[model samples]
Structure formats: C-alpha cells, structure tokens
Target chain A: MRKVSSASKNADRVFRVATGVAASSPVVFLVVIALIVLVQAIPSMKFNGWHFIYGIQWNMGNLYGALEHKNGVTAAAGASYAALPFIVGTLASSIIAILIAIPISMFTALILAYRVRGVLQWILSILVELLAGIPSVVIGLWGIITLAPWVRDNLAVWLSHLGPVVPYLRGPVGTGLGLLSSGLVLAIMIVPIITATTRDLLMQVPILYREGGIGLGMTTWEVVRYICMPFIRDGFVGALALGWGRAMGETMAVLMVSGSAMNLLPHNLYSPISTMAAVIADQLDSALTDASQMAVHALAELALILMVLTLLTNFLARWLVTRTGRRRSTKAGVAA
Target chain B: MGKSISVTDLKAWYGDSLTLKGITMELDANRATAIIGPSGCGKSTFIRCLNRLHETSPGAKMEGSIRLEDEDLYTMDPVDVRRVVGMVFQKANPFPTMSIYDNIAIGLRLGGIRNRTELTDRVEKSLKMAALWDEVADRIHTPATALSGGQQQRLCIARALAVEPEVLLMDEPASALDPVSTLRVEELVEQLKESYTIVIVTHNMQQAARVADKTAFFLNGELIEFGETTGIFTNPVDKRTEDYITGRFG
Candidate 1:
C-alpha cells in the first residue's frame, strides 16, 4: 500500500465527516421537526387529553366570545378539536387510492419492465415518470373540473345500482366532491409513484432467474406471475408503502377535491370528507383567529400526528427494502 | 420416453450478425450428445434454440427446421416445446425465494399437477435422479439458495427433471463446479442418459469423452465433425476437429 501524506489524510478525514453529515441530515431534520411539533402541541395535548383522537367535534369557537380557562390552557368559549373525522377520512381515501393503484401499477410496471422494448419502452417509462413530476395541485384542479363531474354523472350513478349488493355502494352520491373524488385523485397521484418504483425493482431481477422459469416451460405471463413477482415481493411492498406515505401526506390536491367536509363523518362512499393534511390547510385561517392561541396549538397537534403517521410508514418501507436487500445479497454471495 | 431430434440447415442470428451458420445434425434418443466448442461458438445458442429460449433474448433470431422425433419443434408452441425440452444453465439458478421442495415442485405445480402425493413423489424422484436427495432430504424445507453452489446446480437439474421433459439440455452444467462436483455431475449425466436424451454443451474435452456417446465439434457456428466420441477424439475425419481434440486450437 502507498503511504498517504498528512495533507491527504486530513482531506480523507474531512471527506468522511462531510459524507456522514450528508447521510444523517434527513434524520436530524426529522428529529428537529418532531421535537418542535411536540413542544408546540403540549397545550393542546393537555386540554384535549384522549378526546383529541376519538372526539368527532372540531370547532374553533367564536373568536369574539369570552375566553375560558381549562386544563391550564386558555381558549375561546365552546371550542373543541376532535380528529376522528379527519383520521377516518385520511385512512379511507388513502386506502381506496392504494386499492385502486396496486393492480394498475403492477401491470403497468410489468409492461414497462418486460413487454415493450427499445423506443416504446423508453417512451412509456418517461411518460410514467412525467406523470409523477406533474404538480399535485394541477391534478387537484383536474379532479375538481373533470373527475368530480364524471363521478357525479357517471361513476357514482352506475355504482349506486350495485347498492343492493354492496352496502357502501348505496345512493346519495352527493356533489361528487368527496371521498370517491378524493380517493380517485389520490390514486392518480400515487399510481405513477408506485409504478415507477415497481418498474425499477422488476428490472433489477436477474435474467438468469427469469430464464430458469422460462426454460422450465412456463409461459411469459406465468414466468412473471410465478418468478418475477415473488422475487420482487418485498421491494414491491416497500414501493406501495412509500406511495402510501405520499398519499397520506398530500395536502393541496386532496384539499381541493375533498369537498372540505368538517365536523362530521362520511356516511357512504360518495359522502364528503377531509383528511388531516387537508384540514390543516383548510382551517389554518380560522384557527389563527382564536386570540387565546389554543386553536393554533391544536393544529400543531394535528401536524404532530401526521408527522408520526408518515414517519411510521417511511420506516416500514425502509425496513422492508433492507430486509429483502440483505437476503438477496446473501443469496448472491453464496452463488458467487 | 426420450425422443430423438433432427436438425436441418439451422441458422441463428443475434441482431444483424449471424452466429450459427446453417448447421445440421441428428441426436439419438436415450444417449448423451456432447457439443464441444470454445466460447462464442454457438454451442449454448444451439441448445437455447431447441427450446425456443434463443428467441426470448432481445434481437436474437434463428432460421431452422428442428424436429423432435416426428414433431416440428418450431410449429409447436414455445411453451410446449420447452416442456418436452428442459435446460440447465452454466450458472446455478435455483429460485432464491423457494424452499428446496418448493423449487422442485414449482414446475410440476404450474404444469397443473396439483395432487399433493404425486407432487411429493415426483419431487423425491427428481432429487434422487439428480443425486441430491441424500444431502438435502432432511432439509427440504430450507431455502434452496442455502445449499452449496454444486448442490444448487443439482437442485436446478432436479427442478427441470420434475417437469418430466423427454430431453435434458445441460449448458456447461459442471463448468462452475469444483473437480469433485464436476465428477459427480458427470456421473449423474451417465445415469440420466438411461431415461432422457441429453444434449450437453461443454468446453472440457475430457468431460465430453467421459459422459457423451456421440460428440459434435462446433467452430464459428458450423458443425465441423460429429461421430462416435471415441472416433472423434482419436481419428477425426476433419483436420480442424483433430486440431481441436488434440488441443491444437479452439
């Protein structure tokens, strides 16, 4: 080995420290955000106690009303902040988006990875990625203008006919600016995310393994179904979880198409709803009008909740990807 | 039962370049035929063509008339052709996600043999045929990838055999193994020839001599000489065949 000069050694040390900081910046940022949100949410946490999550009411109260003191925190009289409706809305719409996205994304990923080739494959891949790059607010606008109307005039009406078969499919589809519209908009936003990630994962599957399936008399579809899909299972699930995080945290787009339903729960698939993210954006103005500042603290509490949820999902995705990656690497080691 | 294969004027191309230049030959049933050639000599491509695996590669194409016994190979569905002709690659490739039992059972299960007892028996028999039954018998539920490289190769062989193909194509199956494993695979090939028509592509001339009944020499994608292994190794009719067998040139 060549001996390193002291100058070069100092450079190496600096480089290592720099790279380490770059690598850990995300974790540092996450911790700082969590700490700040937790501190800001303390007042709201004391006032609401367990009711913050389970209570259905979410009111800023009249800002002109007399101030009331309770749980060592001051707020406008009759104020309440229950997040049950927003929690349900967030989960339902995101779950609906996931349900609608999985199959479509998988098939699209398959075509991108295996079916098409050359210029067509390149073009399709770029187009899919371009969809991901499009502004979410633009998608929200499209949802308001075109998707909401279609849902009201077509999808909701057609789905209502199946009301006798499925309980959630019942009539009273509303103005179409609700759960179904929010879910559809979210699905469109997440499909490109899931599809692009899945395509990359599918493409990483070794040709040798695929050839083993093909050589064993499996049809092309069978090869994909039995071999390719199973090989990429963990990575694919990680992609879905990543997309789930994005859907849950999405604000502007979901807010626009969500019909901004507040203080109530959706009774059916077509009923209006509001996610935690949408609620934060939609209620901030009125929340700021509360002179006691309790409303702002409550919004901070909501941010804390959203942060924790997204973090959990992101951690789940990382864990899944690492688990599969370690297994694949070990397998490769043995083979080599 | 093993089926004979006959080829006439087979030509293959990878994109615009021709790799196999109109070669023709016949392979007998229930015998191991060794295709000996250097790297890039189309030995592997020729076997890939038999199961239509060659066409699966991007820009790869072939022009050939190959008959599996009385059946035209090209006319049959590629999937059906692959069923009658299974291939083992130069590198071992057992499905990493599967257990040893599942690895062997996959081909059969997908082929619609869902009876549990039948699947178990076939898996056992295939493992035994590939000479991997004893080592892996107790640990059949373990991941197939946990096995050693040579065992994984045998596992792949067993995977192919479980499908009950009439012809087994080994593309340098033992090239990646140690001396001991190579000898074991050669012995397995000798044993397997009693039931299946085996076409083995190898760069090792001694391996061809040990396991093959008939040997074909491929150079620049042409069938230079083909005859009894003993005769080709000893008295080659073609000068190029003698040069290759005697280690004069690839």
Candidate 2:
C-alpha cells in the first residue's frame, strides 16, 4: 500500500464539494421559488377560500366593485376565481398530447434504432434533432395559421356529421382554435423529444438480447417487440414523462391555438379551451396594470399550483424510473 | 432428426474486411465438433455463418456454399435456417423480462404453437434435457434473471432446446462460467450430442478434449487441421496443429 498525497486528497475533497453543491443547487432554487409563490398566493387563498379551486365559474366583471365592498361580496360572486376550466384544459390537452405522441414516437424510434442504417439513419436523426431545436413560438405561429385551419375544415367537419348523438361534437367548430388544435400542436412539439430519448434507450439495449431473439428465428420486428421493447420499458415511460412535463408547461404554443376562452368544460376535442399556462401568460400584463390585487394574487396561486404539479410529475417519474431500475439490478444481482 | 453440415470454400466478411477465409469442413450428424482457435481467428464467425446469424450484421457478406445435409443453406430463408440451426452464445442471454417458463416457451410461441398444454410440456421437457428442471421447477413463473449465472446459461440452453432444432451451434458457452459450472455445461453438451449435430467454438482445449468427438483447429481465418478428436491431439497432420496441441503457441 502507498501513502496518499495531501495535495491529491485536498483536490479530491474540492471535487466532491463542488459536485455536491452543483447537485443540490436545483433543489435550493426550487424551494426558493416555491416559497415566493406560496407567500404571494396567500392573499387570494384567504379571499377566495376553497371556491378558487372547486368552483367552475370564472366571471371577473364585479371584481373591481367587489374590491371596494370587500366585506360583503362572497369569493365566487366578486372575482369568480374558480380554476376548474384551466385545470380541465391543462389536463385534457396534456393527456391528449401524450396519447397522440406516444405511438408515433415509439414507431419512429424503432425504425431509427433497428430498421434504418447508414446515411438514412443519420439523416433521420438530424431531422429529429432539428425538430426539437425549433423555437416554440414559431411552432405556435405555424399551428395557428396552418394546422388549426386544416383541422377545422377537415377533421372537425367529419366529426360534426356524427350529429346530435355525440353531443360533444355537435358544437360549432370555431376556426379550430381549441383543445384539439392545442393538443395537436403539443403532440408535434414533443414528438422529437420522445422519439430521440426512446431511440437512445432502445439503442442502449445489449446486443446479446438481439442475438438471442435472432437465434430463435425471430424477425427484426419480433426481436424488437419481444426483446428490445420490454428491456427498455422503463426508459419508454421516462420519455413519456419527459414529454408530459413539457406539454403541461408549454405556454406560447397552447396560448396561441387554445382560443383562451373561459369554458369550464370542453364540449368536444374541437371546443375552445384555456389552460393554466395560457391564462397566466395572457392575463399577467393586464393583472399587473389594473388596480385588482385579487386577480394578481389569483394568478400567483395558479402559478403555485402549476409549480406543485410540475414537481409532483417529476417526482412520480423519478420514483417510477428507480422502481424499475431497482428491479433490474436485483435481477442482475440474483444472476450474479 | 439431426442434420449434417458441409461447408465448401466458405468466406465471410464484415463490411470490406474478410474474417473467415475459404474454410472447408464436413460436420457429422448427431456428433459434437469442437472448433479451437486463438482470439481473432474467426472460429466464432464460422459457426455463426452456419445459422446465417453472421449476415445480420450491417454490410456483412458471405461467399461459397453451406449445405445442411443436401439443402443449400444460402437458398433457404435465413429465418428458416436459423430455426433449423439454434445457437448458444458465449454469454448467457435469457430474455430478462420473461419468466423462466416463458423464456423456454418463446421459441415455441414464435413457431406458432399456441396450445397451453403443448407449450408447458415442451418447456418442462427442454428444462429437463438441459438438466435445469429440478433447480427451476419451483420458480418457473419467476423472472429468468432470478436464477444464478450457471442456471441462466442452462435456461438459455433450455430455450434453444424448446425449439427442437436439428443442429446447435455453441460459441464458448462455458467460458464465462466458474469451473464447476463449466464442467456441468460440458457434460450437458455430451448428452445433447445424442440428439443434435453440434458445432462448438472454444478457447479451452481441455473442454474440446472432454466434449468433442472431432476437433477443427483454426488459425488466421484458415483451418490448420481437422480430424477425430483423439487423433488430432495425439497424431497431428500439420506442424501448426502439433504446436497448438503441444501448447507451444495458439
């Protein structure tokens, strides 16, 4: 055994402390932001009580007058601070985005990882990267101009022929600025992220598994389906979670296409809706300029809720990844 | 039924680089043939060519003829050729997501056998044949990865056996195992030779001596000599074979 050098030991300690600080910095920032939102949200929380969360109506006509007669006006009557509409919009659009994105992303990933080769593979990979790098505002503008009109003239009309039997689809489609358009925009935006992550994960699967499948006379598709896909199932879930978080927080794109209406519940996929992020972005300037402190506090409360939702989503995703990762390690341990 | 294999002037390439160059040999039916060579000698590539797995690599190409009995392996569907010729790799590779039972039954299911009873019967029979039935019977429903390394290797053997192929190719199947597990695999191979034509590539000369009926020595992508196992070891035809056998050089 050799004696350790003091200089080297000091360097090692420096490296450890540097990395530890870097790792904990994100947690520190998250806590600070959360505390700020919580403090700002307290006024609205006191004024609106539970109705801010549970009530569906969002009328703000009497909010200015009610500010003067603060003691007499009920929370629901004064500010109409209920957030169910935005919550519904956020959940529906994000969920719909995931549902639309997953199949396309997985198939694209499979083709890129297994079926394609050489120059074509490189071309496709670069294309996906380019898609991810495109600015969200640009995508939102494209959605508003192109995708919304196409959907309104084509898909929405086709659905409307289902008639009164499908009451949700019976509503007049409004130039396609609605839940479906917003979800579609989100789906397109997240496709590259999900596909890239899934492709990388699929490629990471050990060659032994592929050979095992091939040796059994399985086709390339079978090898991917029976072996590679299951091996990276946890990674696929993580990719979906990554896309989910992105969709939930996407302000510019959703705000552009979602119509920003205060519809408590969407009538159908085509119905105009507003998400929490879209609402905050749309109203923040007006809320600041106006004398209504209630509106400002209410937006802060929504921001707090969005922050909590994001944190919960990330935590759940981390938990799920670890659970699957732990199971795999235990399996490897048992084999060892 | 076991099938004999004949290779004539076989050459294999990975991209532009030739790995197995013009190798010729005849493998007897229901017998174990051991291919012994040093690293980078293409012994593994030769056996992989028999099952058409070598060609699965990107830009991999092959030349000359490989015949299973009288049928041209090149003319047959590569997938069908693989089904007729099962392979066990140097590493144990049971599908990690599968249960012990499912791992064995995967080949059967891929072969379009859907009956539950038949799958179970074949799974059990394959496990028993691989000498793994007793050890894994109680945990057949558990993930295959829950077993020890040796058990997992046997599980892979069972998986290959369930498909009931005419020929089996093993590429240093026991090289990764401990001495005891190596001995168990060698014994299993000896038993397996009664039912299938087996070609094994090994780095271990003693393993070749223990399990093989005939031995083929490969060096620099060429066959140095091949004959009955005892004769090849005792009475070498080439100086290189003599040197390799005498442990002078690989």
Candidate 3:
C-alpha cells in the first residue's frame, strides 16, 4: 500500500468530525431543550405534585394577592394549576385526527404509487405534497371562517342521528369552534405527511415480489392486498406514528379552532376543548401577568409533557422502521 | 391432467420494439420443453405469453393465438389462464412476510380452500413434490425468506404447485443458484415433467440438454431451430443454431 499523504489524512479527520457533529446535532438539541424545560418546570412540579396531571382546574388565582409558600416554591395566594382537561384534549383530538387520516391517506397513497403514471402521477403527487406546504395559520383561518360554520349547520346535525347507536353522538352541538373542528384541521394537516411517507414506501417494493404475486394467478387488487400491503406494513405504521407526533405537537391551527376551553372537561364530541400545545400559546399573555410567576412555570411543565410525548412517538417510529428493515435485509442473502 | 399448448404466429412487443416476432410452436403434454437462446432473444417473452404474464408490463403488447387443450388462452380471462398455467420466475421471490407454510397455503386459501386439514395436506404435498419437505418440514412456520437461495426457489415452486395448475412455465429458474442447488433443481424439474406440461427458458445449453426432452433455439426475436434435445445438440439443422451450439456466435 502506498503511504497516505499528510494533507489527505488531515482532510479525512476533518470530514469524519464534521459528519459526526452533523449526526449528533439533533440529539444535542433535544437534550438541551428537554433540560431547559425540566428546570423551568421544577417550581410547578413541587407546588402542584400529582394534581398537575389529574386535576382539571387551572386557576392562576389572585395574581395581585400576597405570596404564599408551599413545597419550597412560592406562588400567588390561592393559586393552583392542573392540566387534565388540556391533556385529555390533546390525546382525544390527536386520536381523532389519526383515525380520520389513516384511510384517506392510505387510499390516496395507493393510487399515487400504483394506479397513476407519467404526468398524472407527477401532478397528483405534487398536489398531495402542496397540501402539506400550506401554512398552518392560513388553515386555521379557513377553519374559523368556513369549516366551523359547516360543522355547526351540517355535519354535527347529521351525525347527531347516530345518537341511538353511540351515546357520544347526542346533540347539544354548540358553536363548531371546538374539539371536532380542531381534530378536522389537524387531520388535514397530517394526511399529506402520512400519505407522502406511505407512497414512497409503496414505491420502494421491488417489482420482483409483485411479479411473483401476479404469476400466481392473483388479481391486481389481490397482489396489492396480500403482497405489496404486507411488505410495507412496518413502514406504514412508522409513518402513522410520525403523523401522530405531528398532530399532537401542532399549535397554530388547533389553537384557532379548539375554542380554548379551560378548567372544564368536554362532555360530548362537539364540546369545546384546549390541548396543551394550544393552551400554552393561548394563556401565555395571562400567564406572563402573574406576579408570582407560577403560571409561567406551569406552562413550562405542560411543554415538558408535550415534548416527552412527541419524543416517545418519534423513537417508536425509528425503532419500528429499523426492526422491520433488518428483517427485509435478511431476505437479500445470508451475508446480510 | 397435463395439457398441451399450440401457439401460432405469437408476436410480442414492448413499445414498438418487437421482442418475440412471429414464433409458432407445439409443446407436448407431460413433457419438458426448453427454449434456449442468448439474452434478448425473446425466449423469456415467449413463455411469459403462455401464462399471460408478458402483457402485465407497461407498454407490453402481444398478438398471438395460444390454445391450451382446445381452449383459446388469449380469449380466456387472464387470471383464469394464469391459474391453469403457473409460472416460476428467473429469481426466487417468496413473500418476505409469510412463513413457509403461509407462503404455500396463500394460494389455496385465496382459492377458497377453508378446511385446515386439506390446506396442511396440500402444503405438505406441494413441498414434497418440490423436493423440499424433508429439509424444511420442522420449520414450516418460520418466515419463508429465512431459507437459503435455492431453498427459497424450491419454496416458490411449492407455492405454484399448491395451486395445482395443468402447465408449469419456468424462466431460467436455477440461473441464480449454486452448482449443487442447480443440479437439485434440474432433478426436481425432471420429476415435475411427469405430471405437468413444462416450458423452460434457459441460457445454459447444457441445462436445457439435461432437463428438456425437446429444445427450441431463439435468435434475434425469432425461433431459429427446434427439435429433439439430443438431435439439436448432436446434429445441426439451422446455420444459426449450429453457430450458437458450436460457440461461434450467440
């Protein structure tokens, strides 16, 4: 072997360090954000204890009152913060979004991946991705002006007929600016995301496998159902988890449509609600006004919870992708 | 029962570039017929048209009249034609997510065989016919992809056999295997020919001579010569066939 040039060795070392830093940057940012949120949340954690998650009431209480000390933390007299309603709102709305998004995205992805070709495929794929590029604030404005009214006059009334089958469908559909609207907006936001990911995955299935199904007398749909669909199952699931994380963390659109209800639980599907992400944005003004600063700390605690939730889902998505990817690689040969 | 195939003036094209140009042939019942040719010589396209697998490709078109035991294969539903004439590809392609049992059982289950005992029996029978049951019987429930290359190819044969087709089309089925595995597949083919009309497209002349009772030579998208395997190798009919066999030119 020829001796390595000193300049080439120096360049290689620099390249390795640069790539290493690039790869680790996301982890560094995540840890830093998590640490800052935890430090800010300590005061609220000490004062609120377990009630922060289970209790529905969220009163900043007498911002002008004398300070009270408890659990080594100081706050306004009579101040108490609990996040049950926000937590429930976050989970319920995101779950609804995922349920609504799955079928629509899956069928769209299938069509995009297999049914269309050439210019048509290009146009449809671009249109789906364009949906994702729309600003969330613009979608929120549309939700308030167009979607909210339609839900109140049309959808909520029509669905209330199912009250006999599902008790949650019972009437008393208020102004549509609430949980259903928030969920719908979030669904619209995440559908493009999941659909794009799924379409890419479907396209990646080798033609050899599909040919095997076709040669076996399987119909076109049968080939897709039994072979193509199963081949991409794990990746599809990972996309769903990633979509769930996005829906949970979304703020601008959900905040505008969620009706910003506080200190109360929704009794029906149409009831107004507030997610943690939306609440953090909605209450920042009022929270900043508290002389004791407890309200700000409580908001930070909410941020911490939201971060953890999204982080867990992202990790789950990566784990699922890698696990299934390893299994697929094995099929290539013994060397894999 | 095995079925004979008569193809007349079968011409196939992918987007105006003709791949199989007006080839007519007769494949006997319960006998292995090998189509031997260089790459791009339309031998693969000819067999794909037998099972209607050729037209599945984009821009693929074929003008042909193929009769399987007096039933016009072209007019029949493509799916039905495929059900009667099963195909094994050049490379092994087992369903990655399915177990060996599920891989074999999928066709039976989809064809509406719901009885558990019958499914198990058919799976076992198909695997045994492919000469793979003895090696994989204990791990039949494991993922089909976990098997070796040659074993996966055999598993694919078992999958096709479970459908119980009247004709079997193999396109260079052992080209990707090791020498030992290739020999095993050749032996399996000799056995399968006893029950089904088999048409194989092969690049290896020796493989064709070993496994095929009759051999057909293709060159430049047309059939140059076809005859008994022994005669085609030992005696020369067409100048092109002689050249290809004598290693003068493909």
Reference contacts recovered by each candidate, as fractions? Answer: 0.55, 0.61, 0.46
- Model 2 CA lDDT for position B232: 91
Judged by DockQ cut-offs, the docking class of candidate 2 is medium
Model 1 over residues A24-142: C-alpha lDDT tens digits?
A: 99999988988999998999998889999999999888789898889899889998988989989998999999999999999999999998999999999999999999998899999
Top-scoring candidate (TM-score): 1
Q: In candidate 2, what are the lDDT values of residues A204-283, reduced to their tens digit? A: 99888899999989988889889888889887888898999899999999999998888457878788899999999998
lDDT of 1 by residue, B1-250 (tens): 8999999999999999899999899999999999998888999999999889999999999997999999999999999999999999999999877889999999999889999999999999999999999998999988888888889999999999999999999999998998888898999999999999999999999999999999999999999999999999988999989888888887
Whose DockQ is greatest here?
Answer: 1
Please say which candidate is ahead in TM-score: 2 or 3: 3
Candidate 3, residues B1-250, lDDT tens digits: the string is 7899999999999988999989999999999999998889999899999999999887899997999988999999998998899988888999887889999999999899999999999999999999999999999988888899999899889999999999999999989988888999999999999999999999999999999999999998999998999999999699889999988877
Docking class of 3: medium
Clashes of 2: 0
Clashing pairs in 1: none
- Model 2 scores a C-alpha lDDT of 0.88
lDDT of 2 at A11: 97
